[model samples]
Target: MSEKAMTDIRNDPAAATRHDIALSIDKVRGVLEALRFGSITLTVHDARVVQIDVTEKTRLHA
Candidate 1:
């Protein structure tokens, strides 16, 4: 995406609040909710979320 195209934000507050944030949030929430042992890594680019990485660890009980 072009610099202008990427930084283009000409709309209301709701418009500014797009799925980018919402979806990322939902994903983060989901990971946290179902995570018992693991880590969540967020990748950001140009102030935007570019990726979401989840590392889940399985625990064995004695």
Candidate 2:
């Protein structure tokens, strides 16, 4: 998502709804999985996503 788009969503009052927050979390998880990430931690404050921590595993090639 573009920075402006994200900013728009974050600034939207409807984005704080439980359904919207859940959808956002699911989307983030899907992106991480698609990128083969090891784990992701989402920090939510005031029902908004404040921070995200992603751990990616590096594959070793012989």
Candidate 3:
């Protein structure tokens, strides 16, 4: 398995907040096709995606 992205989920603050869900699926086909290498980072708040970041992967052989 490989580390695809970094996820940071935080609680939401609302006066009438009842419930919140957290989940997201990114269309990596484009990214993979474009760069052919990178990483992904996803941030969510109150079950909503807030941020996303992509970088290069680092692999080492033993």
Best by TM-score: 1
Score each candidate by Cα lDDT.
0.77, 0.74, 0.48
Q: Rank the candidates by lDDT, best first.
A: 1, 2, 3
lDDT (C-alpha) at residue 59 in model 3: 71
By TM-score rank, best first, the candidates go 1, 2, 3
Candidate 3 minimal-lDDT segment of 10 residues: 1-10
**Model 3, span 1-62: residue lDDT tens:** 12322221123354113222222343444455655556776676866656667787657679
Model 1's lDDT to the true fold? 0.77
Across 1-62, the per-residue lDDT of candidate 1 in tens digits comes to 45554455443444445736877888889889999999999999866688989899999999
Q: What is the lDDT of residue 54 in candidate 2?
A: 78
TM-score of each: 0.62, 0.48, 0.37
TM-score of 2: 0.48
**Between prediction 2 and prediction 3, which has the larger TM-score?**
2
Model 1 shows how many backbone clashes? Answer: 0
Model 3 misses residue 61 by how many Å? 15
TM-score of 3: 0.37
| Native RMSD of candidate 1 (Å) | 6.3
Q: For model 3, what is the alpha-carbon lDDT of residue 57?
A: 66
How many residue pairs collide in each prediction?
0, 0, 3
